[model samples]
Target: MKRIRMIIAAAFLLIVAPLVFSCDTTEKKVPYFIINVKLDQLTYPVSSTNKLYAVFFVNFNWTTPWLNLSSSRLQIITPPLNIGDFPLFFIVFYDADNSGTLNSGDIFQGWDGVIVSGNNLTPIIVPETEMMLLNVDLDNNGIVP
Candidate 1:
C-alpha cells in the first residue's frame, strides 16, 4: 500500500536522522527572543468612557532554555519591550483609560496565555497572538478618564 510505504519511509527518516546528527559533539548556541503584545475585541467595558483607557499587558516566564535545571518566575510587561535569554511568554491585552496604568475605569479586557519557547522556536516562526479580557466591573464607577 502507498500509505504503508510512506509510513515506513517516515519511520526510517525519524530513526536514521537522529543517529546521523547525534554523532556531532558540537553544542549549539541559541539566541534570545523579542516579543510584541497587543489588545482588542472584548464586549465588557465598564463604560465607553473608561474603555478608552485600557492598554495591552503581557507576562512571560523567562529562562535560558526552558530545559535548564533552575526555575524562575513570570515577568509582566507591555509593548516596545526587548526580551533576552530564554523567554517563555504569555500575552494580556487590556482596555482602560491612561493606557499606562490599569485602574477602576477598565471595564472590558481580553486575555490569552500561551507559552513561547525561545530555543525551540525562531523569530520568523513566532506569531503574535491577541487577547480578549472579560468585563469584571458590575458597578459603573469606572467612568473617570
Candidate 2:
C-alpha cells in the first residue's frame, strides 16, 4: 500500500509540475502617443479659475479623456493604442464655465488630419520622441467648432 501511494504521488507530481512551472512570462507592449502644447501667453493669459483642456479624436468615432492644461508648455500622454496608423484630431479649449463640454463662452483651437503611426511606439531619443507640438492662442486663434 505504501508503494502504491508513492507511485500515485509521483504521477501527481509529473502531471502538475509542468502546469505550475510553465507560465506566460512575456510582457505586453502597450503603445502610447504624446503631444507637447505650446501656449501663447501674451494673448491668452493663464488664469487660476479658467483652465485649459485637450481631447484627441479619430473621425469623431473615438475620443480620449480630457487632459488638463496648466502651464505654457504642457505635455499630454495618451493611453495604450493598437498597432495602426490613426488620423487623429486634436482640440485645445479654454473652459470658461468650468464645464467639461464646449459652451458659448468657451474658446477653442483644433487641428485635423494629424496622422500618428503606432509602429514606432518605442523610440530611442526621449527628447525626439514621437510627439506633436501645438501652438495655441485661444483669444486670437480660437475656433467656433
Candidate 3:
C-alpha cells in the first residue's frame, strides 16, 4: 500500500511542477512619446549656389510619459553640395515601444541649409513651437507642401 501511495504522490508532483514553473511574469507597456518627421520640398538654384530651401512636417506624441521622459535632441543630415543648390536628408531620434510604434505628440521639425567651407556638417535646431512646419525632402521623392 505504501509503495502505491508513494508512486501516486510522485506522479502528482511531476504534473504540478511544470505548471508552477511555466507561469510567466513580464512587464506591461508604459506611456511614452514619439517624434515623427517628414521632409516636404527642396528648391535649389540652377547656377553655382550653396544655399537651398527645405520644407518638412513634424508631428508629436505626448499622450503619456513612459520611457525617455525628457526633451530629446534632433539631428539632420544632407547630401554633400557640389555646385548648385540641392536638398538634404533629415531624421529624428527618440525611444520607441517594443512594437516599434512611435507615440503621439513627440514629433519635431528641423532644417539643414547651413553651408560650411570645409567638410563639416551643421545641424539646425528648430524651436518646439516653430517646428510645426518643416521644409526639406526626407525620402527624396520630390514631394512638397
Best by TM-score: 2
Candidate 2: worst-modelled 10 consecutive residues by lDDT: 117-126
**Per-residue alpha-carbon lDDT of candidate 1 for residues 15-129, written as tens digits (9 for 90 to 100):** 9999999896864433332223232234433333433332222223222221211101111222332333323332222344434333444432222322222222212223232
Give the clash count for each candidate. 10, 0, 19
TM-scores for every predicted model: 0.22, 0.45, 0.26
The 10 consecutive residues of candidate 3 with the worst lDDT sum are 44-53
lDDT of 3 by residue, 61-111 (tens): 222222221222222332222312222223232222222233342222233
lDDT of each: 0.33, 0.52, 0.32
Candidate ranking (TM-score, best to worst): 2, 3, 1
Instruction: Please give, for residues 36-125, the per-residue lDDT of candidate 2 as tens digits.
Output: 555556654546555566665544433453344342235455565443444445566666666656566667656432222221112212
Count of backbone collisions in candidate 1: 10
Better of 1 and 3 by TM-score: 3
- The list of candidate 3 runs beyond 4 A from truth reads 28-33, 36-145
| Candidate 3 to truth, TM | 0.26
